[model samples]
Target chain A: MAEAAESPGDPVTASSRPLFAGLSDISISQDIPVEGEITIPMRSRIREFDSSTLNESVQNTVMRDLKAVGKKFMHVLYPRKSNTLLRDWDLWGPLILCVTLALMLQRGSVDSEKDGGPQFAEVFVIVWFGAVTITLNSKLLGGNISFFQSLCVLGYCILPLTVAMLVCRLVLLAEPGPINFMVRLFVVIVMFAWSIVASTAFLADSQPPNRKALAVYPVFLFYFVISWMILTFTP
Target chain B: MAAVDDLQFEEFGDVAASLAANPDATMVSIEDPGETPKHQPGPPRGSGREEDDELLGNDDSDKTELLAGQKKSSPFWTFEYYQTFFDVDTYQVFDRIKGSLLPIPGKNFVRLYVRSNPDLYGPFWICATLVFAIAISGNLSNFLIHLGQKTYHYVPEFRKVSIAATVIYAYAWLVPLALWGFLMWRNSKVMNIVSYSFLEIVCVYGYSLFIYIPTAILWIIPQKAVRWILVMIALGVSGSVLAMTFWPAVREDNRRVALATIVTIVLLHMLLSVGCLAYFFDAPEMDHLPTTTVAPNQTAKSS
Candidate 1:
């Protein structure tokens, strides 16, 4: 067990003694390697975010992670010219957006048969599958961005469309009409363009200049498809 | 006898000099004949292109040397084991996708690109993208048809997603399985035919479907003529890729079997596109019809 090794505190002291000069120094750790170590629990995290150390040592505090994820959502919403979006990219925001957007797009359960929208899983798959393909396309085009970083940008940029979906859901709550439909259309189209702009801005610097169009086209299609879902979803 | 000894010493010195110069390629050539892939990008240096194989053999090392290295061992069930299949670089994937998009006739895609490194990453995402492309386009076409009709309520035919997923994944995975099995059988029957690993065949099928992603999007055009043309172009590009890649694999078989194999590959490709066209996007041509959902002429015709 690492308990004994933890008590030693300083391995250098143990090795400095002349008696053990011929013997190898003693050190023991990594009994259980954990991803939690690399998470670094961003600067803005709460003071006791290390509460994860008190319980299961393998994970950071659930609250700290949620806070970090929330900050990322803020980055996506604001689209400030800051690297915070790229610096601490994570899939949690994307996953939440995809699920909520999928749920919002789903028709009421009152009548599944006649109610036409994509299946719950269909929206889920389309969002993720779209993000991944866009990422892969950029990667294939020799974009220098790391795979997950591209994914994080593409996924996070869905925040606008996610907001658009939420707005669409609220608007669909009203009775269907030409004026109402026009409102939803305007909202969805603007968000669709915003999604593309946000993603391309984050992705543009990394891509080779000549292939930027090839990379951005898929991002366009990806958001257009999701916005299509948002626009087409009827109450 | 003296001249013979001098000649032997000279050859050994030459070998030592080559080893000293470029140890990596010379080492590869020294042991494994199978290691020297014909398409290996760079020619081995320190030896002539023609004699690199024959001379670098190090056949003179008659003394037994103990080989002391692990055989790339990993446990079969771990993620590490399957990780090898997905190991690939970005440029390689880009080249393969380009090849699939515009298949050059007489070029065997498998031997040139895939056999060196058959990756599961491109294939997996390609199938996924195709699934969404078909499903979303199906929904979009349906929505376009009845955009502003009073009586028409847009219910997305949810089944399209499942159906597209089933048809596409089955084609990408199952057909490759069947084709790989058949190729294996043919390889045994006709010894000289080139054969590919199942992963490589799956890779070929997966990448070959990349054309359909754009074609499926183009299916949103409410005109049947445009849709068919798109499918035809996609099938034409992708089918030739499959056939050309597989022909070299099965060519040594009897003419009947070889021709049958190519015909089946192209026909199956045709069937998939046509079937998708008919099932998913088959709707009233909104382009010909007026903006409203009412088609009184069609209704009268039906009645």
Candidate 2:
């Protein structure tokens, strides 16, 4: 049964690892590999021992990727095809999404001026922490993906949440009644589910069949929290 | 039926006694599902009855037996029944309260803190107690002023006072409940996740109301300027706590929504604080005027 469960051909059953066992294994394996070879090569001039300037080729690639991300922002909603694109670490998409989320959070408040710094910092930290935590969990569960790659996938997965946030903002403009709430509620739920499914789809490949649920649980929580924040946005 | 009523009364009396014995014992351990609650600080507190029922297999018995047992056991509406909600440790409650008050970023500490410690009882009771205190003190102050006047003035209407207190207390939980429901609905709609339970939201809201306890206590001062200062402090502490707690939760791609949520929460907190001050603390003075005018007439008639 375990062998059948672990079989690569059985995608449906492969990731359904026993919850307690997987959790125990992850906790016990404290020395799990967290880093891999940097896939995106630096194309810039060496500026310092730690910091290097971006080379023209690398800069061009990033610019091109940013353009692609912009052109394919909608791909984040239906990210099955975008999985191939997410394989290359395009930090701009995540960065833009993070900024957008932060700005969305700052809307209509009296203390927006004073709150801007902390709000942005809070959003950035949460996103990075969530990505890192999910990455660590995946790695501990024998995930094959690199940390940066996982971060990219996780970051792009927030697009549905972004959409949900936008819809919530629009919905809040209307009178707050059951009908308006229902509409906001419906949009957020759909987007939140999309985000979870999308993240799981992209990230779940590396986990063993039994540990898959364990891996997806955090992702679900991450997106659900974001969706909830957006949904409860009462202006 | 008579036997069952006797049992019910006896159980109720025991629960009341236990509660009176340990008024501060808010923690209830639910570590063992099947076994009766053993770590309850005071007396056994009715879980023994549950264990007995389980042992008798009365849980799965025939309808008549179940009905008789339930009647004999008392309806599941007692304080002990709700004690399960206060499952988190007292130390953890303090930790969460601290975290919610000073929510530094990086790990989304408030969110994680809340997720880990999902207790509703401590906060619920604390808020209820604060509101109740404010209500009682307001009524007491009014009653005292009326006594000082020595006029057969209209006493503070018990019905109105009780209803007002109940409404204010209900608002403490009701608003949070509504927001929780909205958030859950949104979570289900958007992420298809029910991340925080209703109790967890209640827990957060309850802890957030900690500032109001002091404010409620200060309401009895009868000085408007001093009372306003206390109200401001209450609003500041509670508002900041809420902002810190909810910042990470509401932070999203849409700045408007996040700002709106924070503002709404703060405004709601302010509204409740101000409303408590306006209705419970300050209104007794206005209510005294009508009574003072009526008191002279009543005294004259009596004389």
TM-score of each model, in listed order: 0.63, 0.37
Give me candidate 1's TM-score against the actual structure.
Answer: 0.63
lDDT against the true structure, per candidate, is 0.70, 0.58
Q: lDDT score, residue B194, model 1?
A: 54
The digit string of per-residue lDDT tens for model 2 on B218-241 reads 677656777788889778766776
Q: Give me the runs in candidate 1 sitting further than 4 Å from their true place.
A: A1-70, A80-103, A119-157, A170-186, A193-225, B1-91, B112-115, B147-149, B283-303
Q: Candidate 1 chain B: minimum summed lDDT over ten consecutive residues — where?
A: B62-71
Q: So what's the TM-score on candidate 2? A: 0.37
DockQ, candidate 1, comes to: 0.20
Q: What tens digits encode model 1's per-residue C-alpha lDDT throughout A92-196?
A: 988888888888776767766555457788788877877776776667555678889988888889999989988888887798788998999999999988888
For model 2, the local distance difference test gives 0.58
After superposition on all CA atoms, what RMSD does each candidate show versus the true structure?
11.2, 23.6
